[model samples]
Target: MLEQGRIGTRQLSILIFMMVVGDMMLIYPSVITSYAKQDAWICALVGVPLGMALMLMFLKLSSLYPEENLIQILRSILGFWPGNVVSVFYLFFFAIGASTHTREVGDFLTSQIFQYTPVRVIILMFVITIGWGLYHGLETIGRSSELLMPILIVFILVLAFCLLPQVDPSNVKPASDVGVVPILQGILISIIYPVGELIPIMMIIPYTLKQAHRTRDVLVAAGLGNLLLAILVTISLLVLGAFLTQHNIYASFVLSQKINIGGFFERIEAIMASSWLISTYVKAMVYLYAFTVGCAELFKLKQYRILILPVSLLIFGLSNLVSPNLTFIVITVVPYWIDWDTTLSIILPGLLLLVHMFKKRWKTKSSG
Candidate 1:
């Protein structure tokens, strides 16, 4: 379904990477700084191993059903009706994810850049672009990321370099301020935010052109992306310190504001916001692609273009439904996201993998 486009594992990997880093760029640093303080970077380091394990599970499942998307693979292993049920869960998850992202962009714009702009307008602009990207397919999404990643990265790195002067090694002092508990909590939250959400890759894995190398690419890209994320969080803590950055709604943006290069190159939050916007752009596109594919699969449609506007409209409405304020969204997203993302992305896929393995073992035993 969804017009049957060909995309390599590399493309999907890049999309996943973009998705994780995109939205997280805006919120994660602030969240980490709040709990872990100067040790927020520790959360990132701790999160990596767990995230990698989850990714390996995904790769194994994808390898087990090389030619099938998640829905098809579930169908083969769990029977038709059960598979459809699982797909419905995935569809719900994807839709929520889109709405959550919409809220994020809306929050950022309304809270920071444009105090007067309506969230509906911000949501509409992104939804339109996401719908356009979905209409074009995954290849278009991949190509856009490939082109935009470098520019976005350079902007972030430039901010890091500019802030190097203000970085106080003492800011990272007293490493374990509160001890392991908070760090552990932060790590758990990190897994849910970035790693758990990556489960959508299962939908794209079957579309990979380099199916033989799917495992290698996903692991490599994911690992590198996590490392980069950790480094970014670490820099935020180093530059802003725990106290200032922790309470700041947009820590990364605040950090950019501190980047005063001879006082001439200041007020770089705009640039940082631009960088984040690019990442968010790619992230939204991936979800839109998934939404289109899932809709097409569910309805037996030849293409998903007809459904794009309707889904985007739904997402726009859901974004408003989620929260009246950024504080509420931020507070709610942590636990809610972790539970939903882990259950559907990790728990469900792992169960399917286990079932498939058991069936194989039984077949072998019977044959013997």
Candidate 2:
């Protein structure tokens, strides 16, 4: 059953914005820069429409069965047994996704800020904080996001502006120096990582108060977020150069370190780091909430909150298992994650839409 609580259209929009650009702002620029070279910004621009297209697929699926979330929609469309199997797979996908985010939080903190801190301690703290948010309820998460998102935006914009003096326009020249193929590849990567991973929003859409126009809100918010991402990528390329950005693991953090305003704003990578931590917290909350809620619905449980602790513990364990070293995590995200994200975000939803269309037509023909 869908939850009794509802989030406003604006709140939902903000949540979607945070979800898309959250952890992505810190990680994706360098990955795209590696593939697209000086034309990394162009890849981000190209990804905007592709992301919108993916968002529309999600909106369409939700609209067809307004009363049900994705798990229930799957059951309705695919039948009980098969849908149960697929739902379990989706639950597993969400768990793994959340685990990766958890690991990312730990990894970033340990590698960049707290070098001596144990990763296990960092992960434990991160999970507990997000778990507390989940335990409070979705409305709490939505309201918290609404409050924090503007501050996050302001920090990012300030950092970007501060870095302007250091940016080399010449660094971004020779656009398409590597030609269309790599730029297209970069666009796909952008789509898969930030834009396409929006598949989880399927669970959130049913909770929107303005169900009829949620699609437009999602598209607009996601587009705005992608525009911000593109601008960040442009800044990263201009300030750090494509070569340095491609080689650096934490390019955005390094870019933050470049900001020096009369020597006062020096070493404000902490601000950038804090902003990322806030955004990642929201992203992890969304994933964990989806997993908890979906599992509750699957098992016909009365309350999702009851599952929070167990799930959080499980996620904490899985996060450690995600990688023994940061290198393995990078290896997975660079080449392998796109395929996994695409299967869940694009292919699965596209197939579901096709089946629903066929079923509708069959009903129409029978009635005639």
Score every model by TM-score. 0.94, 0.97
Worst 10 residues of 1 by lDDT: 1-10
Question: For model 1, how does the per-residue alpha-carbon lDDT over 1-368 read when each residue is reduced to its tens digit?
Answer: 55567777667778878877878887888777777778888888888778878889888887887787777787899998988888898888888887888788888988899999988899888888888888787778778888888887788779778777777788889988778888887887667677777877777877778757667777777777777778778887787777877777688888887777776888878888888888887776677667667877876787777888888888888878877778897677654676777688777887988899899999999999
For this target, which candidate reaches the highest lDDT against the unseen true structure?
2
In Å, residue 15's CA in model 2 sits off its true spot by 0.6
The local lDDT score (0 to 100) that residue 324 gets in candidate 2 is: 80
True-vs-predicted CA distance for residue 190, candidate 1, Å: 2.9
lDDT of each: 0.79, 0.87
Task: List clashing residue pairs in candidate 2.
Answer: none
Q: Any runs in candidate 2 off by more than 4 Å, and if so which?
A: 211-213
Clashes of 2: 0
Clashes of each: 0, 0
Model 1: residues with Cα > 4 Å off, grouped in runs = 211-213
